[model samples]
Target: MADTLVAHHPLEFVVSELSAASGSAVTLTPEPFLPQHIVRLPAGSATAAVAAQLQLPTAANTWSRTADGRAIWLGPDEWLLVGSESTDAAASAARERELLDLVQTVGGAVTDVSAQRLGIRLGGPKARTVLAKGCSIDLHPKHFGIGTAVQTVLGQAGVVLLALPPGADGHPEYLVLVRSSFAGYLATWLLDAALEFTSSSSAAR
Candidate 1:
C-alpha cells in the first residue's frame, strides 16, 4: 500500500504520493523563512557521499534505509528519503540523476509515490504550543535550534520537524511535515488549541 504525504499549515496545503513533507508557514509566507531539502542517499554510501558533497565538518552520526530507498539521518550521515512528486518534474529528475552520480550504488530500492504525503508550516509564538499538544518531542528552540531536523511522532502520526531560520519579527519558525490523510484532522485540532491564546491577544497591546 502507498501513502500520500501532505503539507498542512495556516498558509496552504499540498498533497503528494510520497512519504516525506517539507516547508512550513512559519518558515515562509506570514512569518520566518525556512527552506527544506529532503533526499535519499545511495545505501551504505549515504554518509560518505553527503560528507563528500556537503563536506560536513564531521561525519553524519546516523543513517538508515526504509523499505524503499528512504534513507534517514538520525545524526550526521543518516537521513530519511521519501519518494513523492513536485510541480517541477524536470528538476526532480535532474536531482535524481545528480544523486545517482554523486554516491555509490543505488542504495536498496526506490518507490514511485508521486501521490501521497503532504506539506505544512507552523509559525509564531503559538506554533510551539499548538504542536506541544500532540507531539512529545520538544519544540523549544533551545533544544531543537535553527536548521535542525528531527524525525518523531506527533499525535501518533510519523512526522519530520524542521526548524527554520528566524522570521522578520525575530521570532523563530518551524516547518512540520505530516501525512496527508491526517492534515484536515490535525488542522482542526491545532485551531481549536490556538483559541486559548486569543483571550490574551488584546492584553499584549
Candidate 2:
C-alpha cells in the first residue's frame, strides 16, 4: 500500500494562531509552509535566474529577492530559496519542484526542506527585547539590522533568524525558522518572556 500518513505542521493545534502583547509591541504568529529549498549552487544560468544583480548576492548574511520569492545567502556557494507563503500542500510541492528542476538544469543539488522547519513571525517594538531574553546574538540595529540573516541559537533551539524590513506599523520584524520538534518549547519560551510586555494574544502554550 502507498503511504497513508499525513504530515501536520507543529503549530496546528494552537487555538489562537497569533500571540501579541504590550499593546502589540511584541507578537508571535505562525507562518507555516513557506516553501523552501536548500541549494548548493553550481555555475550556470540558474544562478543568473536567482541572482539579484546578475549574480548571487555577494554580501554575507543578505538576501536577493523578487516579488515571488527570495534567495537568502547562507554560506559559500549555498543559499536557501524561499517561496511565497502557501497553505496548500500541492501548490507548495509544485513550487519546490519548479525550483528543483530549474537548479538541476545547472547541475545544482537542491533539497526540498519545506517541512523541516516551523516558521514563527516575530515583530513589534519590543521584539528585540523578547528575543534578547534567550538569544545571545546582539540585536542592536548596527549589528543585526534589517536584511541580515544568520544561523544561530535561539532559546535553546537552533534557528535561522532573519531580520526583515519594518512592518506596516513601522516597527521591526523578523522570521524565526526552527525545527518542528522545537517549536513548542520555543513558543512557550517566547510567550513567557512576552509576559513582561503584557502578553495577550496567547497563540500556543
Candidate 1 on 110-150: residue-level lDDT in tens? 33233334445566666677778888877787777775667
In model 1, which runs have C-alpha deviations exceeding 4 angstroms? 1-50, 54-86, 105-116, 198-205
Span of ten consecutive residues with least summed lDDT in model 1: 14-23
Alpha-carbon lDDT of model 2: 0.76
Q: Cα miss at 107, model 1 (Å)?
A: 5.8
58 Cα displacement, candidate 1 (Å)? 6.3
* Residue 94 CA displacement from its true place in model 2, Å: 2.8
In every candidate, how many clashes are there?
A: 37, 0
The candidate that wins on TM-score is 2
Runs off by more than 4 Å, candidate 2: 1-7, 15-22, 43-56, 199-205
